[model samples]
Target: MFKHFYGDNITEDMAMKFRNAAVALNVQISPAQVQGYLLLRKEDPQASIDDIATITYCK
Candidate 1:
């Protein structure tokens, strides 16, 4: 979970901000998207946010 990497101090507001940002960029932001984002963020740190958005929307 995000707490594992980002630490337990990550507030709900911060999490929501990430969700909002991802959604604003066109990603179909959801709990599943959040999980995928965390995975992809680890595997490909340089991956484009838009790419995530595309995949989320297409799926």
Candidate 2:
């Protein structure tokens, strides 16, 4: 999905930003779980990365 949004050219940097943000939101979360939320950004571009990370905690 990350590849679908960012294109087949998804980069390490792109995925890494989401991975880092997820960890910041929840120290216990795994990269795989974080990647799930990262895919969501493709659906809601209005939200910032921080906002995306906070979604799991907020709701």
Candidate 3:
């Protein structure tokens, strides 16, 4: 399910980086927010993980 939504570039390592960034910022991420991130990525391929994270999780 994650593979289908996130695509191949978002590997475990990359996901861990995202999780780590969230932890660093004391942000809590949810599955729905992940879906939102995927959509945001589809719209803006150049969007950074931090930006996506902020948009989805930081709310």
- Judging by lDDT, tell me the better candidate of 2 and 3: 3
lDDT tens string, model 1, 1-59?
44454555566665555545566776345666556666656544224333445546432
For each candidate in turn, the TM-score is 0.38, 0.43, 0.52
Order of models, best TM-score first? 3, 2, 1
lDDT (tens digit, per residue) of candidate 3 on 1-59: 33455667567766666556656766566777767766757644335455754654423
The lDDT, on a scale of 0 to 1, for candidate 2 is: 0.54
Best by TM-score: 3
Report the Cα lDDT for candidate 1.
0.52
Candidate 2 positional error at 17, Å = 0.6
Q: Which candidate number has the best lDDT?
A: 3
Query: In order, how many clashes per candidate?
Result: 0, 0, 0
Clashing pairs in 3: none
lDDT agreement with native, every candidate: 0.52, 0.54, 0.58
TM-score of 3: 0.52
